[model samples]
Target: MSAPEQRFTPVLLTLPGLTPTLALEILPHGVTLHRLFVQADGRTHDLLIGPENPADHLTQKYTNTIVGRYANRLPVNQDAFPLSRNGHSSTFTPQSNESPTVSLHGGRVGFDYVEWTPLLDPSESQLFTDAEKSHLNGSDGVVGVIFKRISEDGEEGYPGRLLVETLVSLVEPSGPQAESVKTGSELKLGSVVIVYRAKLLDEGKVTPINLTQHWGFNLDASLKESLTVKEHTLSIKADHTIELNNVGLSTGSLLPVTGTHHAHAEKESKKIGEKWPTSGYDEFYVFSPRSTPTLPTRVPVSEFTPTSDLLKEIITSEASSKDPLVQLASEKSGLRVSFDSNQSGVQFYSNNLTNEKNGARKKIHGGSGVSGAGDSYGVGSAAFLEFHEPLAAWLNPSTIGHSGNDTLLASGEIYNNFVKMDVWFKSPVA
Candidate 1:
């Protein structure tokens, strides 16, 4: 007679030290990132904007949850396509969620709505290889959890049984070596790493998949005095953005951000509210292609073993790179967050739709009550940075051979997506 009670497992991770500089809370439902606390300016500040109640995650607007099957939108007229791969062919038709003509964030019931099984003990799961198990064992200041789930065949109109695993971890920051350090005010840094991997279970079935985390961030440290990100400085390393139609669907064309308002924060950091666009940014900034190692053609499920190599590769690449793909900083909090990913582009949404008029009130300090616009909890209160492949590449027949392949996962192949968020604090020199 009553609805089944929803359940969630909360996992806490803290920096390894006598006094922790950062703490993170991860929930297996939707494999959500519930909370993040960063110590800066001699105070502890909550960095993420989420619902007051954890259970609200299911109904909220993707506060901080993993989106999948397809991360962004697809046209409503999604025609069935014969995916011919590995000597087999199957028709694939994506399910629509937003409208009769558009599918938003993987149809009606996406990964965000499901409860992922947590692999707290990697040794118990066959998905991880021995090396991956050891890496997940969390030694030497590393702590994380792996959440996994299976999407049955025909769910959401996608073919094949998909086994998805998401690894979320908090690691101590690696700064300059002691010998190279100058004796000035040092910056304190901490990192949150997310790795997504999936494989098709059917021997010859193929499917399309794109995954991303919808994390809305508000850097102000004080929950009682929460403020909009209007004053925050933003910088993105993108030269162009995919053109979108009036209703926000990709137009199958790329436009340079060189002379538009999109370029305002491309070259240098700028206040988010300065000369703001009327509708705010719901744009996908495109990044130049990166040279990454290709995966093997096929590895049967029985012989397949997900490794730590993908995670290591992301860390190694970030360490060697000079600049991050995206960066956001707040002068008030003296805190900065940087994002680096192997994906080709990132979608930046300025929380433009969150307002009382829209029935989307801001929740303070993850509390139950709502706040008014004057309280800085309304529109522009936060920003969502989603890193993933080009939007609707599959809709265009011409580009499907190249950019579109990023979303296709074939039988005997592995799917991996890596993203890293580094948080730091730097005080002004006196």
Candidate 2:
């Protein structure tokens, strides 16, 4: 007998209005965010960079996909940690997938490559409360889909059986109280909200876990234009960045962003191409604890109610009281995207390694009489913003203390990761 063929089905989430402002495509393979269409300037624009065909996602490198077991890189030699629950104790050790020296994004077969099961009736989910389920099922103009998966114990050199649930939703602007900003036009604002929840199913067991979405963005709207994100301006609400070694792993040191090209403060926006570094950015930016409201690392399953109000609180807190955690605007499209998350830090990558040689495809417009055809993308074609705990912080808390107990999930505990992206059109003057 032959191995069974994998099936890929995508779910679409949209607002309640006849002319919805936003639409999101959730691909089951890896529970990837396949595409995001935003209506602006009387036209619909695709804000995310992804493959044209759904199956093409398998060939791409974490393109708009949820990555985990562990999100980022981990040292090859991981120390065994003790896990004790109800007087039962055992040692846990993490396995590496990248090479003998490192582990990149889970293991060789991480969540990114797995096919997640879609929950047709989200009410049956164990991760949401009744209030949250009602709110997510169209109340307050919210629509979403939940994808669930089970990671068997020792699947990726990690302990415990993990139940993971990912909720991808679109929340439209509700009334005057809706979290929005005035750009050039009086466009109603909306957002793409992603919530990741996980729990250990094994009794008296523990595991190390870190989860995140790796979505590459290009505001150009069309691949035919073949524009790079260097033309975009960016701002971040961070004062320090995690120091990295030559191989790109955290050195357990936090360094100031002042007086550096990486210093794109909330008040000081800078063009990504101006004074650019050869390697582009693959660094982790640390967020100040006092800058945003404190969020719990673990929520009891019974009390895990992520209502619309909670979503608003996470994204709007920055919109109302402070600048967004990170902002990127495109001058060509008049489109801007702001991100806010409960994670302790973010990773900004400029797609430095993407190019025609890497099999990235883009539409090429012919000159004069020549016809247009498909072509490969070049380096810096897009910007990737990953919201998650500081990389490798679980190994050395003293050096990256902002994320206390974020990567460790104990028995009977639930882990929640929330991220929101608000999109709207902005006039050049504004």
Candidate 3:
């Protein structure tokens, strides 16, 4: 690794005059990534794609906000299959998978739809916590938040109880190359990493869990014509695979992504086995194995193709987020997630399915701002960089049952919180 030249001295962003209420839809999560309302050359573009009124129903909608208690899909229900986090548990079916059996992105309503009670400050908006956590650890500028969910028995159908807390923090980036003055552009630079840490407190029973975000993004820089990312390149770093069950469920089944699994076979771009592709790159390569007390510096980040001396890719890319706006994740490991203190597999999906004409940010009247266009589906779109300690990595049915509880820690062990990472959106100088 090389030493960085500058570090990002983060300037807290806050809305002036606009009601702390304007940012309501984004609260409880932390900072809101709003489309800066701007009009240049006699044109108007509100990067956020919203209307003059009722923001939800307007031309612009969908913010890649923070979500959880548990993210992605649980493959069960928060009501029936009670999970054990924070010493209690619940069960709930999710909406992420094609199969009803999978808990996809927090059982339909997870945290996305609901309104979060806001506690506004000048620079940062403190979220609603039935107590989520807040603190300073190891570093003074470091601040941590704990979002906990205590479940009633049989809330999702499974047994045992649950208490879950996801801790998210902002730390000053250190290193010879720590500062980015501009982001995702070739200007003066600095680096600021937004870290999300999670800890689960569970009751006495084994539970199968996976969490990541659905933060979708579009990287095509041109506003007039939609682009296909097939030409974009990708590379995954992990060499091993964890065998998952038929439903891709992993309470305790461990294996690699290289198998007869539907995803492996159905998706050609999945990059399974040793066959690497210069194009159509989409798949999860396991992060280097980390048992515990792992240093963030030591773990090998994913690699990319068209290798650059600057990037730490387990995977590599011809596509540079610096130009043409590539969307790489640890792949949405972008929404970093830690669990039971155990680190597992992370998934990476490209927005091959993004349709500006028919997207979540549709505008009839039109919209556009930070990303450029003033119409419905404008420039530089969002990316879905998800994160989670995959159960698939730990699920090994042969060792245990389909339950896949092969770990010896029993039901009450401690799992470090999940971590959410965003694009540092690097600038030039640092």
Candidate 4:
């Protein structure tokens, strides 16, 4: 219990049920912070940069740290979320409020909280080779963490003998940082790149898998009150959208959200806003370049200054001394993101609030952070972000032992998708 007030340290949880084996390296840039490790608990999971404060989860109270077992809920009508829908398996399935269908991420013990084991070096021969294996020791410039889990047949009511393994790596930054590391091993102007790969082993054969992370982003501490993301523009070059059920669950309908009005204004009004009830966004956004308007490549779409509301593409958040403005721009900005997944949908939430849990606010120690008081952090400081999702698969072992004969579900064949995110930060305008 030797915890410091304003410093960062490695946290180990000896809680029950968990084997309590290893711990991750805590990374803090300043007041903002996070953790980094390769081999968690026993399975593999990565947030690219590990896990940020998740920006926003459960209204900033931090309830939903990572993606729940299932990204969203299953359709009320379906007995269970169908592993295969139509001809394609969508990674980001939509949300649903109906019937037995519920939300599930990695089911109970996902990757986020798992303590990973670092495999520094597997061997030079294994490099770039598709040999399908595991390594704990990572390289000096890179980090590799590995983890695995075997789900029981009826764990989450799925049907698959689930033997899943994930590998996460932090590659060396490719920018200016790589050039000036002459003195030692220090990076200058490069960003950390995260990569995740997981597969389901069936009778020692490769099967399909789905996975994602539940990462939220809040530019300003108090996402809503700061009243800025508008400055943060969104420029999405996607062509297809998966129609979600009432609660946002993917109904297996991948279409375009462009022309679909939340409602028809007596067939007269050209401007139609979000559907009647809720305001905050809770829908999956597809990344399709084919359906894009193809604006300039380097220009960013300022969400703060919305040109259109087809999607919450980018956000612009700024604060001026006299009347500061937060702006997010995207002129396509030579920046493009591609999302390929096995699930059906993606969810985005804003941190309108945070937890007063420990009486005051929680200051992030591993990364750059915002204060609750705007200039300083106290109680109730919030964070917001857009994140990936990891899928959930229930395995059965009481029957087949090691061959993966009795499976509750085929699980992650669809969610094995990736999101291409390029986030840029610049000093506040003078």
Decide which is better by TM-score, 1 or 2. 2
Off by over 4 Å in 2: 1-6, 78-90, 175-183, 186-188, 221-223, 301-322, 360-374, 401-403, 427-430
Worst 10 residues of 1 by lDDT: 367-376
Instruction: Output the number of the TM-score-best candidate.
Output: 2
* Candidate 1 runs further than 4 Å off: 1-6, 177-186, 221-226, 264-266, 290-308, 357-376, 397-405
Q: How far is candidate 4 from the true structure (C-alpha RMSD, Å)?
A: 15.3
lDDT for predicted candidate 1 compared with the true structure: 0.71
Give per-residue CA lDDT, model 4, range 5-111, as digits (tens). 21233222111122321223321111122432222213322222212333321122223232323343433334334444223221223233233454434333333
Tens digit of lDDT per residue, candidate 3, span 1-430? 1111111111132222322101112223212232222221223323233222233322232244444434433454344433343353444333444366775444444444333323222123221112122223322333433333444334433233544333334333223543333442321111112233222234355444444444444322223234223332233333343444566554443445444331332124342223434332233434443322321211111221123221111002112222211123122111111111123444544443334554333342233422223233322233244544443222233323222222222243433323323122222233
Number of clashes recorded per candidate: 2, 0, 136, 140
lDDT string for model 1 (20-53, tens) is 7889887777888877888765677778776555
TM-scores for the candidates = 0.87, 0.88, 0.49, 0.48
lDDT digits (tens) for residues 1-430 of candidate 2: 1111333566888888787878888888998887788876566677777666667677776889999988888776657666554354456665666667678888888999998878889777877656566767686677888899999998877888999999888877644644233534534458788888888898777677788999988887463464588888988777788888766778888898899988987666689888689888887788766444555667755565455234445433445223567888887878888877778778888888765444435321111211122344557877889888877666767555454654778777788888878776754545
Model 4 ranges off by over 4 Å? 1-69, 76-100, 106-140, 175-189, 204-209, 220-230, 254-278, 290-346, 352-361, 365-423, 428-430
lDDT of 4: 0.29
Report lDDT per candidate.
Answer: 0.71, 0.73, 0.32, 0.29
Candidate order by decreasing lDDT: 2, 1, 3, 4
TM-score for model 1?
A: 0.87
Give the top-scoring candidate (lDDT): 2
Candidate 2, residue 185: lDDT:
51
